[model samples]
Target: MNRYPTVLTIAGSDSGGGAGIQADLKTIAALGAYGTSAITALTAQNTQGVRAIHPVPPAFLQEQLEAVFEDITVDAVKIGMVNTVEVARVIADMLDRFKPGFVVFDPVMVSTSGSKLIQDETVAVLWQELFPRVDLITPNLDEAEILIGGQIRTPATMKGAAIQMVEKGCRAVLLKGGHLVGSTIYDVLAQSSQEPLILESDYIESRNVHGTGCTLSSAIATYVARGNSLAESIIFAKEYIAGAIRSGADVVTGYGPGPLNHSFSPVSMQIVS
Candidate 1:
């Protein structure tokens, strides 16, 4: 019997159903992969902002990871929004144990309000523990700035940051340049073995920009699970996210930023031998 290509998302939950675990599942399903999750925290949030966050106990989180890994054949993993040091450590440990074929980490270190979400110590721990375990790390401009302790104002700096992150132990880095002031968004993919690739897309003018990072990372994981190369997966994920944003541009889900239309182009669940 064949099994559906599965991508497990280790992230937080957003009650708004736009980002985090919600968006990850949506993207995985849309891209023809079965999705599983081990939630590290739950946030009371909406399109506007986060209100409160309740951490899942480390022991329970470990149990969730064990349960999924023991039963499911997770082909790829996408990680997001790990705020606490304890949660970060648990995820790193689980990755070491299960050794999933592909791992993508979206270093969600900053909030929409331009505030640091994780502490300095937690950041160090992520670099120490998780950076060496994952295949790719996707960080938006703000998060990249935080990680490198410098501003990224141009494409050159973005590429430089990606290289710096790869030197820090990530196998590859996708430095998202969506926050750059322009109509064309630039995402730089830098790997240790190849020349940096620049992916460009038109900036869709939409309030429905929430969950894009989660959605993109999940899509990449699904594509990788389905046997696409790392660069190919990133290309496909970028296209998928651009389409989702364009499709949901006019829809209104909340007064603030809304969500991408993840199902705009859906595929049947892919089966693997």
Candidate 2:
């Protein structure tokens, strides 16, 4: 019997189903990997905005992690929206213990609508503990600025932030240029051992990009779980996300910004049975 590549997401739940754990699971399944999840928080959210957030206790979060690690051999992990310092500590401990082969972190702080998802205190712990454990971290411009305690206004600044993040112990950093103002979107993939790689794509001007970050990170994890090299995985994930964004361009889900086309095709979930 052939075993399927498995990817796990430890993230918050989005009731809107366009982002967060919902987007992660959809992206993983769409990429032919077995998707699993351990929800860290539950948000009553939609395209309009986040109405409420309920964080799961650290002990319960640990229990969920233990249950998954005990039974399933998780090939890769995509971490998102850790709401508290305790939750961040629990995740850091788990990373140290399990030592998963490939870990992709989306340091989700501010929402697309400009609301903070993680606490200020937890941000420090995330940098000191969880950030160092991941194989790669995917952060938007706003998050990059928060991580470095400065502004990232240009490509040069983004590169500097990525380098600093690598110095902080992450093996590599994928600093997104989506938040920058321009017709062209540039994403930098930098590693300590290699020169920075720039991925430039034409900006798809659409407000329906609710879960692009979560989707991209999850797709990268899925590709890694399927044995793709780091560079290759990120490139493929970018292509997948770009397609999803374009596919869902005009469709509106909620009153505010909508989500991507995670279920755009049946081929999105091509499991190896």
Candidate 3:
């Protein structure tokens, strides 16, 4: 039997092939996992912006979930771009059933190009039905602002908001500080029982950052599936993304912010006991 840690991505598809299911699968494979997918939406988008989004029917979405879990021993899950409340609730029910080994939720609310990806009603349902199920959530600054109803312009505010996500029932929160203006970026990982862990890195100047959130969360899930501790997974994922950004700094793929070079490197898959 294949012993590689398996990761399933539940997210949208980007026609641009940079930010959604594409990035998740690339990151999962790069991190050395068997990557599966249950696509939640399809966006007609490019590096410039999202032109349109078509959500998979709720029933079909359920079937996709069932098909993956029924056949694969999913070691971890990475969730992203659930665009409706119905989809959100369906995912919750499925999670309760399968109880995957680990779950990383990237609560994608908006696209990098200023497009709304989820409904306003779905926001509340995420806090209610989805928040408690996630092992960790990787939300960018705007997402954190919406979740906490306050501006998170500084590292201090990021810490407070990370705690708020923990209070709301997320097992952990990776509040991304990429959107904040700074010479250094900070991501706070906060959990219910443990003290918060703050990760800092110098910002690498690059416009090719289209699917960073999706990529980071997928890398984390893949690492966790490999049986690495959460802290270690985050650290490793951070290093991977930083290297990706630095490597792709001078390259250009589109007129606007381009996609990361997710296939720049690949690691051997972990054989988990």
lDDT on C-alpha atoms for all candidate structures: 0.90, 0.90, 0.91
Residue runs of model 3 more than 4 Å from their true location after superposition:
none
Candidate 2 Cα deviation (angstroms), residue 205: 1.7
Best by lDDT: 3
Put down candidate 1 lDDT per residue, 1-273, tens digits, no spaces: 899999999998999999999999999999999999999889888888888888899889999999999999999999998888999999989988988999999998776645455767888898899989999999999888888899898999999899998888889999999989888988999999789988888887887889889999999999999999998899899999989999999999988889989999999988888
Candidate 1 Cα misplacement greater than 4 A, ranges? 113-115
Query: Model 2 over residues 116-219: C-alpha lDDT tens digits?
Result: 89998988898788887888999999998888999999888888888888888888999999988899998999898788888899899899999999999999
Candidate 3 lDDT at 118 equals: 93
TM-score of 1: 0.97
Report RMSD for candidate 1: 1.1
Candidate 2 deviant stretches above 4 angstroms: 268-273
lDDT winner, 1 or 3: 3
Query: Please, what are the lDDT tens digits per residue for candidate 3 over residues 1-273?
Result: 547789999999999989999999999988889999998998999999999999999899999999999998998999999999999999999999999989999999999989999998999999999989888899999998888899888888889889988987788899999988779999898999888878899998998999999999999999888889989999999999999888888888979899888878888877766
